[model samples]
Every structure is written in structure tokens, then in C-alpha cells.
Target: MADAPPPDATGAGKRRGGTSGKVADFRYKRPAQPEKKRRDARSGHERSGPERSGRERSGQASPLPSQMRPDAGAQSRAGSARRQAYAALDLGTNNCRLLIARPSGENFTVIDAFSRVVRLGEGLAASGRLSDVAMDRALAALHVCAEKLRRRNVHLARSVATEACRRAANGERFIERVREETGIALDIISAQEEARLAVLGCHILLEDGRDGTRGPAVIFDIGGGSTELVLIEPGGPVPRILDWMSVPWGVVSLTDSVDGPDGTAAGRAARYAAMRAIVDKSFAPFARRIAPYRDTDEGIRLLGTSGTVTTLASLHLELPQYDRRAVDGLVVPSASMRDISTRLSTMSEAERGTLPCIGDDRANLVVAGCAILESILDIWPARDLAVADRGIREGILRSLIAADAEGERSREELQRARDVTRSGASL
Candidate 1:
């Protein structure tokens, strides 16, 4: 709730102090929709009434993603009122991903999706600013998202930039450029909000705790520039956040910080050890705080939502290629995960690239991810590691939909009250 930084030369808000935080952008691009609709969505936004677009009548809506299904009444609902579409864009240090969805009953159905590894945080740990090349890559990806938003006529949308933007000196400058270029505002969310969103998005996949005695669950999101670890008390509509911490030691940051030759076994081991030590130190405070949970009757339930865990889960499944249906919601043994991490940590980048899921895009960085994962295991020692492909984007969509629902209910109530007032006046 603090005042945003003052505008600098670039017209983007300038950070006063060297603070480590993030910004997240929320937008609703309605190129095809009416100007009033666009303006309204920008301020308070649309309600998810059954509003059908031309495309829906034409049966041109994009198919839902693998994780979601179309309800039987989806088509009927589309005709009721204005079908308000929502979009969530997550521009992280390592990847640019976008999801566009429409409310379908209690859940939203994804209409379109896009993902590309832009590595916006590349060299950020060393440079303390977003490099031109990285920014260009991210902008290119955002352009695609912008186009999609326009074509989909997204009524409610939010685009968030994580660790990379949060850590860079010119983060706001780049955000301004993004807004000017793509008409998409990028919000660099704080670490705590990032952690909360990640948990909200993926915690549904947590294995039932009622099967046995349940302990507090641990949900961690390993991003490109930073990693977030959140502890929660389960058994509620949504897990209540017990405690959490965000460390600036994700794949890109860790790998850049501890650079060495990993082509050889000895070299890889040495570099991996360095990475672990750094993460261990970064996580020491959180570890000490959660020491009590380690001794619970039922050990910690750990759920991970990030490219790191998904890639590892793919490797565990020995999939021919990355499959979201197979990887998402998977429960892998902790020991097995540790073994995979160790094996991957030792393998040279080239060797790792040759594997099924850890291709060239993830070759060099997977080792750092492994190190972080291992350090997590060392602390929270969970029996099983649950994998989630969903995170911030899903969380954003859910929030937008929930807000829309509330707005819709309020509108209905107001209408009913007006109807009663009119009747009384006529009487």
C-alpha cells in the first residue's frame, strides 16, 4: 500500500531505495469490444454474465487446455449475457506465458495459451539491470500475447513480471516500454503476493491430507530470478498461509552467481555444491522458523509449481516428451526426486540437453534448479513431491473470476432492490 515510486527519465516509476520487490500488471485489452466496456473493465471491470461473442456463435472459441474441461452448459451459458473473458500473463525471468479464459461454472475454461522461454532475467544477477537482448525477447513474446488479447477481446486481464523485473534497476523503464508497445501493463508483484498466488493456483493438486495424519503443507515456486517457499495450514476452502519467504536464488540467479565449468564430473560437483551452499544460506532463516514442522507425526506435504519441478517430474516419468497431463498433479517419491537431481546436477549441460525433457532450452539451467530442489528437500524432507504446472497465471484468473462473481451478485441485489422500490411507489 506504499506510494509507488516517482517517475524517472524513462517515465516509469523509479525505485527510491535498493529494495528487492516485484511488480504485477493487470489489464483488460478490449480491442474489438466497445470503448465503454474497455474503460469499465480497466476501472472495476466486467461481470461474468452469459454474454456471447460472434466467435462463440460461430463455434470458433479455442479449445480448453489439457487441465480444463468444458461443462455441458458452457455453450448455453455463453448466450445468457456478456461473456467476460479474462487473461493472465506471467512474464518471469526465464519465460513468458499467457493464458486467456472465460468463466465456466465454478471454474474458468482456458480459451488460449502461449509460452516461450525469453530468459528476461538472463545476466540480471550480474548486471543488476534488464539487458537489451532479454528485454527484446520478452517484448517479442508480449507482442504475441497482446495480439491474442486483442483477438480474444479479453475483458479482464493481468500481466505480472516477477524476479527479473523486481531485481533489475531499469525494471520500471522496461515495464513502461512494454505498456507503450503492447498496451499491456506489467505489474511487478511483491514476493509475498507471488507466493500467495502460486499457492492459490496450484494447491488444489495437493494430495488429500485426510488419508493420514496431516501436517502443514509446503508449497514452493521456483522461478527464473527467485524462488518462493510458503508454509500453509490445510483443510480449508483454501489453505491459510502460515508463513512464507522468497529467496533471490532461483535457476538463473544461482547459475549466474556460481559460474564454473560443469562439463566435467568434478567441476559439476564443485559448482553444484556452491549453488547448494548459497541457497542453503538464503533459506536458513525460513528453515529455522519451520524447524518444528519437521518433527510432526505426518511429515510435511510439499507441492512445487515451477518449470524446475515439472521438468524433474517429466524425467521421473521418463516421458518421451513434456506432457502437462502426465506431469501436472504427479506425485513423485522424495528419494526418487533427490536421485534425479543428483544425477542431473552431475551431468554436463550437453549431456542433460540430450535427455527427454531437459532439452537445450533448459540444459545449462537445470543444474541450478536441481541444486535448489535438493536444498528444499534437505529442509522440509517430505515423503512425496507433488508437481503442479499451474501457478501465477491460474491464480490471477481465479481471482478475476471470483471478483466478477461477487460483482454480478451485487448487481443482481441492487436490481432486485430497485424493482421492489418501483413496486412500492406504484402501489
Candidate 2:
């Protein structure tokens, strides 16, 4: 592996020298926890495990489930002692997400997960800056995530900020403040890395060539400030990554740009249409890039990872509340996605808020997000759409673990090579 960039160069390891007055001035009361005991027990076990090893144990302490030990290699890997829980926090354009898991053989079971729509990119389209109201909402959510991270006793944690923070002028300042106040360093990753990690996170969901052969699949992540699309060919060494483009539009950005509160059905339709047109135009280049793969008769499946698609799945199930397991791998028909999009677009903000899936916090912007998803499907026709609740955060965790493993192997290889050279020289 190549040397990692300098700490300051990559925005991953830079530490702000001192806490800011803004951070020191505010005294935050600890939030109440209803399930404190469960959290405490989990953290206690995590703390008792090996400190440096990246291996994660099954959440079950007694014996690993047969289902959890899927393969021989996984079983062998799990035989090792467990280590600290690894945490990945993604502060995206629309949401703040965190995943805590210990490595368990080939796969990791989520010990705890947190997601909340703060719409940090709200008003960023027009203003080119994160709004104060949005920042407050995001900060509150981050505080919750930080507390959870602490309770999990995460030994190695990585927090990242995406498109909204990447584009905003004050993004660095906001990150600095977050570190000083919350002690969470936010890494604003480039679009390429973002695309790579999303594909990695969703790689397991790619269709295996069992029933019938499927061609390359396209994965789309409709984020708050930007959208990422990746094309993957099944049974291939790696995703060819035919094309990846982070469009300057997402749920929050698009909704702020086009939606209105006119309280009229026609107005809402017009808003949806307008938003659709804008997204379609933005996706034109991406469409053209994937056009060559479309004509081959090799069916391309669409896998969507973001709040937009998962929320639509939640609503389709008529779920009273969001369930990640239910929505994660759920396959929604294109027709069904269209139906939900239409229904959501027609409802007033107030009406949408009252719905089970579209809560008060996300009611207004979800339609815009849906429109983006619908527009992409329209352009890139797919047999079925897979919903993934995981994305950047999962990708980050996987990459960090993989990178650490690679680094260790590289060090061993280097030492062996040196020893061989020395023996040859002595002989």
C-alpha cells in the first residue's frame, strides 16, 4: 500500500490546537437514556476484549451462531481473541449516521447504529453555506452519536463529512468547531473515495450468477448535497467503475431549490416535475457514460443506498416505524417506487408529516429525494431496485479495517525481505 498522505494534507488527522471559546462557553446536559443498562453491558464487554486487534466477536457471548459462521475462513478468523469495537460516523449532507461493530470472522454484526436526518445541507443550494438552523440540528444529532460512540468504548473511530461539507466555504471551520466541542474529527473525503467506499459497502448485495447471469450493476447513492453512481460487473475482480459523478444536487439541495408550500396539489406536482427535470438534466452525463453497457442485453440491476430509497421502502411496507433489517435488502419494484413517489409528491408538507414513514422532520424534503430516485430509474431502467440502509459509514469501517490489515501484511513482508537480503549478504 502507498504511504498515507500527511495528517494535515488529508483532513483525516489534523488536530485543532485548543478548544474554542464557543465550545467552552456552552454547558451541555447529558441526554437521558431509556436503555442505559443494555448499552452499559455491551460497552463493558467491548472494553474487556483485546485492545488492539481489529477482530469483532459475535454479539452473542456464549457461542457463535452457525449462521454467523458462514465459511471456513470466517470460522478460523473468529477463533482469534476479539478486540475493540470499531465505529464509523458519517455526517452527510442530509443525515448523521453511525455504525458500531466488532469484526466477526468474515462479517460484522452491528452492535449499535444511529441515523437522524438533520438536513445539514439545507439551503446550501442557494446560499452556498450550511445554514445556522441546519447546523444546530446536525450538532444535536452529532452529540447523540458522540455519546453513543463513547458508551460503545470504540477504540478506533472515524467520522467523515461529505458533499455539503466538501463544498461549503465554512466547512472546515464547522469541522474544527465540532472537534473542539464534541471531540469528533470529521474527514471531508473526495468524491472518488466516497464512490469507492459506497461500492465496497454494498458489494455483498451484488447479484450472484446463480439463477441467471446479470451484467454490471449500477449503485446509486442519493445523498443530501450530492449523488454518487457506480457500475459493477458481477463475478469480476472489482467493479470496473465505468463512471462516477457526484452531482451537485441531493434531497436537501434540490428541495431547497424547487419545492414550495403552496398547499395546492397542482403546485406540488409542478414542484415534483421541476425537481425531476433538474435531476434528470444533472444525470445526463452519467446516463451517457453507462449507455454503452445498456445495449449488451446484460441486465443491470439498480441498488440504491441513501435515505430516499430506504424511506420509500419503509412507507411501502406501511411500517409504523423504520426498521433497518426490513429495509436493508428489500427489493422494490420500479412501479412501486413510482407509486410512492407520486403519493408523497401529492401530499402537503403537513399531511406528509403525519404519515408513519415520512416523519415531521423529513416530510418536506423526502418528496424531493424520491423525485431524484424516480428520475434516475427513469433514465437507467433496471429490473428491480435494492434498498440499502448502509453506505458511507459502513464503507469507512470496511476500508479502515482492510487498510489496517494491509498495513500489517506489508510491514511483515518488508521485514522478511530485509532479513533475506541480510542473510544473503552474510553468506
Stretches of candidate 2 above 4 Å error?
Answer: 1-82, 209-213, 411-427
Query: TM-scores, in order shown?
Result: 0.83, 0.77
Q: Summarize candidate 2's per-residue lDDT along 341-425 as a digit string, tens digits.
A: 8888898888989987667767877987888888888767886788876676676666655554554578678989999999999
Q: Candidate 1 — which residues are off by over 4 angstroms? A: 1-82, 210-213
| Residue-by-residue lDDT tens digits, candidate 1, 93-122 | 998888887766666667777777888998
After aligning candidate 2 to the native by TM-score, how far in Å is the CA of 262 from where it should be?
A: 1.7
Alpha-carbon shift of residue 418 in model 1 (angstroms) = 2.1
The clash count of every prediction, one per candidate, is 15, 2
Residue 9 displacement in candidate 1 (angstroms): 33
